[model samples]
Target chain A: MASPDAAAPPPTEPERWRDLDMLLSRPGNLVHSTFDPSPVLRDLIGSYVEVLVVGAGGLGCELLKDLALSGFKNLHVIDMDTIDVSNLNRQFLFRIQDVGKPKAEVAAKRVMERVSGVNIVPHFCRIEDKELEFYNQFQIIVLGLDSIEARSYINSVACGFLEYDADDKPVQETVKPMVDGGTEGFKGHARVIIPGTTPCFECNIWLFPPQVKFPLCTLAETPRTAAHCIEYAHLIKWDEVHSGKPFDADDTEHMQWIYSEALKRAELFGISGVTYSLTQGVVKNIIPAIASTNAIISAACALEALKLVSGCSKSVSNYLTYNGLVGTHIKVTEFVRDTDCLVCGPGTLIELDTTSTLSEFIKMLEEHPKLLMSKASVTHGGNNLYMQSPEVLEQMTRPNLSIPMFELLKGTPFATVHVSGMAESNGKKVSSLRKLRVAFKGVEEASKMDTTESS
Target chain B: MINLFKIKGQKKEEAANSNGGPPVKKQSPGELRLHKDIAELNLPKTTKISFPNGKDDLMNFEATLRPDEGYYLGGSFTFTFQVSPAYPHEAPKVKCKTKVYHPNIDLEGNVCLNILREDWKPVLNINTIIYGLNLLFSQPNDEDPLNHEAAAVLRDNPQKFQRNVQMAMSGGYVDNTHFPRGGGGGGGGGPCYVLCFWLAPPTLAPNANHCTI
Candidate 1:
């Protein structure tokens, strides 16, 4: 691609993307004039560079078009969403015919058909469905998602890509740069996250205010509102009726059941305004998103992505906030990166006993307050300490789960184990990959601890 | 006037006595939290609430505010608070029923309060919004004002604006225009008040004998 020797018709919309070529032709670019005299270095950035755009909603559609028009030839968009009639007002790439169709596939197809010489690969699946290897191919990952949990999940995955030397310093080569854009009403923000260098999403976790919580007494003694009834059904009645099965918000039957139970409670309480939409909103914690805001934020995200990929100029120095409400107030703030960040920095250190087996360690991971990992696959120094997938790997690792913790550590004082699993975040099941530093202690300490606890 | 604080307690007692569908009716987290907020409501003495429809309509109600101190002292302004089923999670839709010559309050009665809009968070209870509104009367923010004219006047000429406010409050002429004593109608007095205290023949109305509005 750098040579432009392979005969692929001259890049379409050459005039439209002429400035982008000028950017790559600058001395700072990797494929700049030092090596080749041909324009392939400029062209190589387009065809060879792999960029993954996560989410295919309003902002996602804008990112696809913006990235395509910016001369990004290899683009991949992944979204586990269908085109709903509600999405039409802002998601410009979709239409009435596209309703019920996978947003990623349709968005990709529409962008390809509209923008010439740009190829987009669409993955119509959840981000968790794809393995770490699937994400490794992308040079830059752009996030246009509305869900905070989803953003954190991706952020954790990006940080999980980090590898440390013997001195416990993050290797720069393994760092993944992520550009995230979020819009709420006329307010939006675009943040550049080069894990270990800039603040990862988790570093500013407090930036997102806490979710709404209700008192159990109010829920039990006095239910006055429709939300009360919905919560009653969701939290209490569901458990009362279906004991073992977890309540799935996406399941139509489960939702309808909740709605009916809520309506009954509402009627009994003499409360009104319990609509289906409201039920879904309360259950899912849905935010009302506006279109133009999405477009503005997504444009910033895409531009930042381009800047990251092409060294066009200094990227948005960490974070950019846009407010269209009060006469278009845009503020760029450089948030201080957290040095003790669990995702980007050295992980939480846990002291373990040599007598503790891998089986006990797995149980400990599930019980740990900070981790609370319901499911986990452990990796130690790039080796599969344990895997729950691909039956053969699981079989091979199952034996290791019973082995002594000292055997796994193999004379090491401390071992960094990577755990990938799902955690209950914001009341939603979100995939999280974390690095855990385990220091093995003597067998006497283990037996002493067990005796003290048991006694 | 509906005592909203007692509304939930009575409802629970009534449900307990009735032919119950289930032994226990569950409440939403938001509802439970809002109930706590209502129980802990420390409303100012100047404020009062009444459900125009009924106590059953806790989701919608009318709240009257009497500014005890400010340029709007002795003036009573009413607002409607529509609590969505989402309650604490969603900010209640609050709109002034009687318009006033305030910088933060628009001519159409739309208020310029941060808690009701972008700055709203789940932790912000109705009490917070009440305090916010009360603060607006005492110290209105002219910078982010919805009523630009009022804001300009308040910013440039405080004394003249105070005179005009006093004049308008007493059902008298400030410049060349006269305002009805009870309601706010300098320019933007929309006809949305289908029923209110403004129904009485105003002192400023010349054709009050024949006019229905």
Candidate 2:
């Protein structure tokens, strides 16, 4: 046996790179590679892997790193905006030299240099209404967008075809699946949407509608001053520089101040208007670490996709939110469709006349004033009157108060009446002035006299 | 000085003379495995292991850890560990004896580590669990938290969480509750009682600094 102090054999650098290179060269080699077979890979086979990264910002870059590390062969990144010096703070894929370059191009180039033998395609285009055509090329779509509108559009497009059917129903069909990543300050959330199976972001936010639809514009539009813009840009740059890096107390405090100020400005305006400024605040408060969290979430989503394709874990029809700051809390909530929704409601028919153009429809509305009469109004209860549509009126009438309103409107041409003193009626108070078309002896007599009454 | 071997020899003689068939030759396999696990423990330098019932009973032991970093710095925390006979296969029952202000750790000392719950697998060992516990001190997760107040503070104002932890560790009041001697498990029984005080409430002066063991 060798002595304890005997010179140890020279350490061997792990040949993991060579093995990885070999695996990359051979498509079939992925199967035999000694690297533990991911439960995700059991499903992803045969087809050329096409991934579309929607936001080439902080989270987008981190996700790119994770994807490249995981050995994904084909990657496509799309972002309309060019990189600014401010982005250097948290957008890891871009460098100081790449300040003026488009985010997508710079990120893709960075990926090429860092991870060889992978095909990365960069697109400098906005994912607006024309996203379907662009999105069709990719097998998977990952959203790192800040706006809920963009997220909703992506979600709707990915899950279903926007084309109207014979019944005028938007043919809800899955095109490409998507994953959504969002962050609020240090906290971050990642959710996977598998078309109809999973609870979409809309479904989850529907219960608490106001929380998701806060009135604020992007920083760029509201705070139009160049100084504010530059300041905001600086915040983004700070985040980009510190991407995937730990922050000290000073840095955290500075970022918190910048973000809180930006938020105050954004709340005063609107989110879209102040995009650039708010982007700065969002980046400072929710980049690098949050982005890293999002990357992990995106990777998990990719794994879930692989599992879904492989039939390991059956299509999970629920939204999974992973919160890293609070110790990896995972909440899976199911989505239930709202039957009474005006947009995606059940049994509600939408028949779009093929010959009518949008402008022509507007002209028709202007020409026929009676079409506007679809909304009829009635006034009741002298003072505290509130306006409501017929549907709301039908729902609000109680047996006791229902008779007086009906009696007052019996001879009127209006289909719906606005009820005043609703607060008092709701409070069970007796009112003296009973406004009516015909004089009634009392509420009991009015109820008895009505021919339409169902006793 | 008397040799330990001689004393053992005398005990064997006494046992043999008292009509025992034979002195028990060696410790059972269960005791042997427990001893090995205890001996091989790679506890941190800041952590100390003790047996309140003396060194003979390895089944019941306590681990004291004084974290040197993060919000819980300068705090002395003790955890009791009761290992079952089936040990490695079954997790040891761990209870925090010190009160800590943390999102993941409740007032009752219940922890929310995934390894202790659904994510636990047979492959994981005690070292991994201990490291995970240490990580909880370094970084507390606010989501899926046992203490909503701590979680909210951690989520809304991380600085406040740090301050609260510091105040609690220094044997001061946090949110109107006094910090226990070990952190959480000092007062034996009652609705509420001063942890370090030896005397009843009426006898003890309010200003006295009680440091009873």
Candidate 3:
């Protein structure tokens, strides 16, 4: 169902010819204008071209400029935060006067001023939990997000709506096939996710996890001074949460004000810190450029969306990352899905049935421990201490956990005991644990012999 | 034809008399192209270009930019440019000769600007590249970053970024390492060149002359 405002007259489309005339007639237009006079611009006129750009940062603005220049009719930009004075450095869409302004609004206005003929709608809202109706109207969605959470959410939403075929079979899968664009400093990536067709983000999650393994005490450790703590909180923590706030112009400005306050708090606190001496300045400036690259990738996603909507190119499901600094090296790879995936695996959906409730499932698991064993048997060591089923044991013994075991017998009534220790005549320690072996006859005979010996 | 030969001989004689150095040769078309690009460079007033080896060698030069804004404002930062003879066909090698706190520039001054590397094309001229460099000084991106710490700081605290820049320019310690004098250390016993002169406030304490080489 459409939102109440869906019926409301959509924002008035910009007068394309008026702006086009201005651009063409501008004095320096000949030198600045890079657009080719082609039929593409004429074809796009008056069409309700809906686009969803997820980021309103640097690359996002550039993409908007490109789209407007290319003559796309309708545009929507979604971002959660406002412009800071620092954003004026690389976010060319915002000027010093535009500091503390909502980035989406500033970007939309700039786009309108630079290139016209499209309806620009700025949403100062987070991308997560956005109404599907908002998504359905757009022919293409561009993800100019920075974090994995937003990227994953966008991917999930796309997967739920779009269906792709693999080997001519209609595969029903969740997690929409979408493009994820990200940048960190000067490096940027544009990844396309098609559920069941190409690899999902999860397939390549290991490539860019939270932290890489670093040796302990490899670098100097300094106490978090008040100023340093405040600085850390302002730049690293606040923006992360604030960037996900709902779409409101005032809320966006408040977030910028909060950032300013955090900066002041850090200065008052005087937090001293250390970092890799070589890269401090480079890191600071390059990051926004990288974010801008993400925006470009997001626009590229729009191009791909056009392809998908127009039945031009095959819907891509591969992942691609670009490192601009190293060279615009676009690394594209296919991601294979894990059959045993916890989220999208077969029959793994958590149905809202009487037996599927958390309490009921816990109770069922407690009552039928054997079911746990059956699942555990597929894993190694599950059968050793815990009574596991044969199915699990069979699965565990396949190459990865192929540890050999010996069958040991006790007294007369010999009971078969599986032990991991190897038999040694020299009696040397194996695996740093002392090993001892003893043979016993039949159980009844062993018991009688034990009794006789005791007597 | 006789006058042309005489003129050529006179040029040879002039070349020999000057320094008995290599004969003055006309610049190739490519060199001329690069020369025009460099000549037309409308660098920001904050940016100044110099040839460390002298004006005769335009292929190798340095650019010094004193940012008037952002976290690096008032700090004198120098970047060395080594353009190959095949420049325009290849991106120039740029290094941050200044040690400052930045996310995209490493301590060694190896910049991560995309235009200088992956995104470079022959179509891009010296003017565009300089603009990109100046943009870096004015706005540092924290999202896609080489210096994670600097990026994190810029992303988290713009005010702190300002403080760090001020501290670094004033020759104070940022974190622990001393901010290099004028963002350049006294390396190889080279005399420090004063890139820019600023009138210190009357109340501020007087100190040694601030110069950057």
Candidate 4:
């Protein structure tokens, strides 16, 4: 008989994760083609995998709960918004007392208190404040972001880590997977993005509708609706009354002043329904967040993340949308990636010596047969290495031109640089951003750094 | 050749200086648009633009309109224009500095021009507004009026409205409302042809002075 000490530790509450264990341990016919079922697969999720939850609002709160209960033990959440009295209805994890606190911190604390054996780290800062290395640490990223800008930023960060061989095929090991979910009123969408394999956020950016803007004349003069009145007070009157004083949407006093002024304007215009809450909604551009919609979307996102990590089932084909306005309607669409996508596809590869200066690089870009750029503004990993405009930025980054490329890049032997310049398209000079993969020769051991397949 | 980079740099410096103190403010899109609008302003010969607070302060200015032929003909009216920094987006607030007995111009000096109110558009610039104000003098619409009494008089009796305007231009009283002396004399002793033109009110005459330039 095996010694008791050598035996595997007893499973804690064997029934607690019975459903998850079943899915991970015994695969069904619908499982992914690469899926290999085993009891160890369940243990991998609890022990090794690290998932990042990128928001702590409505969908974010539900995602934390769903992911925690689904055997993802290590989780991190980041949010820049503080909880408000208005967030109480949909953001379930936050209570009345938690108002004025960071949504991430409060949500993390609440989720940890409810779920056992789960560790959640909260980052109470903007997503832009974090370093690229911080994002690279996560095995899977689950997004519950509201804005297109934030989604695009994180998507670029994940895609920034992708690499390709000489054949322009993405290296499987370098692809960072992301599951994104968003809810607006009774509509929501859940999408799975495997950086290089699937269409990234930027590829289908047109899916989002442009924001509605009231004509300035309507808001200033006519003001037929209550919204026009609120917009008038928020956009025009506030500036005219307080010249030099910027209206902070977050400040209570400023909001109160706008609300009162809007109310007065509404009364003058004989338009009703101008409330303080409505004023905040208009000023902040708040989307009507429905809790049930968030719940459904977050569940979909969590399942996609699980399928991606454990290979228990085939993930949703790129994108899934839900509409609950009239009746429950759900659909999944297999979206294709853009072949010439600037964000995902491997950029034009350039080989150069480590001793090449930044000025030489700019000149090379202009003279390169494929690039043929007129004037270049270069950035690496979101940091501006050299800029060619605005005079101030150009002057500040001018000194970098004299420094060696490797010295500017510091530790990395190879990195992707994003360059914006005037390039000829259809015989006309058009400004566009071109991604370039720059590899410095003789900087490190060539054999160890060689990633391109000879075949 | 226009150096866009150099012009942008100078604009940045000007924006910083105009911002006065502390925070170095960048030139906002609104300011840039306003600058273009002001540069492209095409005013009529009947109208004149002046910066009351000097050239540096473009936000506040005054415009004087000398109508050559209309009910308010030969009457030079000054309007104080307080333009918000949100120009073109928000119509400039204009108040008549010279009081007159007209259907659109109220006792409170509010001029009720459609473009200045409900019909305003961002594409309509200071030039369009100046032309609209001049049009108000040439063809005063009695349909929508801030001064209800004057509108009723203009609608009920055209001749009575003409006499009242002539009395108001000569610093006389009509219906107990006192009027200030205007720019040019439209008194009984003026050019006989001018008085004859006043009788017609030159409703649709090709009066180049007030015609849309």
Alpha-carbon local distance difference test for all models: 0.68, 0.49, 0.49, 0.73
Instruction: Please give, for residues A278-353, the per-residue lDDT of candidate 1 as tens digits.
Output: 8888998877778889888888887787666655556778899999987989999999887756567777566687
Q: In model 4, which runs have C-alpha deviations exceeding 4 angstroms?
A: A1-12, A355-363, A366-369, A374-412, A422-431, A446-455, B1-213
List each candidate's DockQ score: 0.01, 0.01, 0.01, 0.03
Candidate 2 structure quality by residue, lDDT tens digits, B89-184: 345656555667776665545455555433343345455566666767777766545556777788899888888877776667777777664354
Superposed Cα deviation of residue B120, candidate 2 (Å): 46
Colliding residue pairs in candidate 1: A214-B29, A228-B28
Q: Rank the candidates by TM-score, best first.
A: 4, 1, 3, 2
> Compared with the true structure, what per-residue lDDT tens digits does model 2 show for residues A1-455?
55432345422323424443443334443232222333234123222456778888877787776666554657888888788777776787776778778998988887776665667888888775253455655566877777555676566455432233434344433235576776654555566665433455544443322211100111222344433433433423233334324344235465565555555554555433444444444443333445456556666655544433333333344456666666667776666654322112222121223332323322332233322211112232211121222222223322222233323333222111121111223335321111112122244355445734653
Worst 10 residues of 1 chain A by lDDT: A29-38
Candidate 4 clash pair list: none
* Model 3 chain A: ten consecutive residues of lowest lDDT: A213-222
C-alpha RMSD over true interface residues, each candidate? 26.3, 37.0, 32.8, 17.5
Worst 10 residues of 2 chain A by lDDT: A211-220
TM-score of each: 0.52, 0.37, 0.39, 0.64
Please give the lDDT score at residue B122 for candidate 3. 60
Q: Pick the lDDT winner.
A: 4
- Is 1 or 2 the stronger prediction by lDDT? 1
Docking band of candidate 1? incorrect
> What TM-score does model 2 achieve against the real structure?
0.37
Error of model 1, residue B155, in angstroms? 58
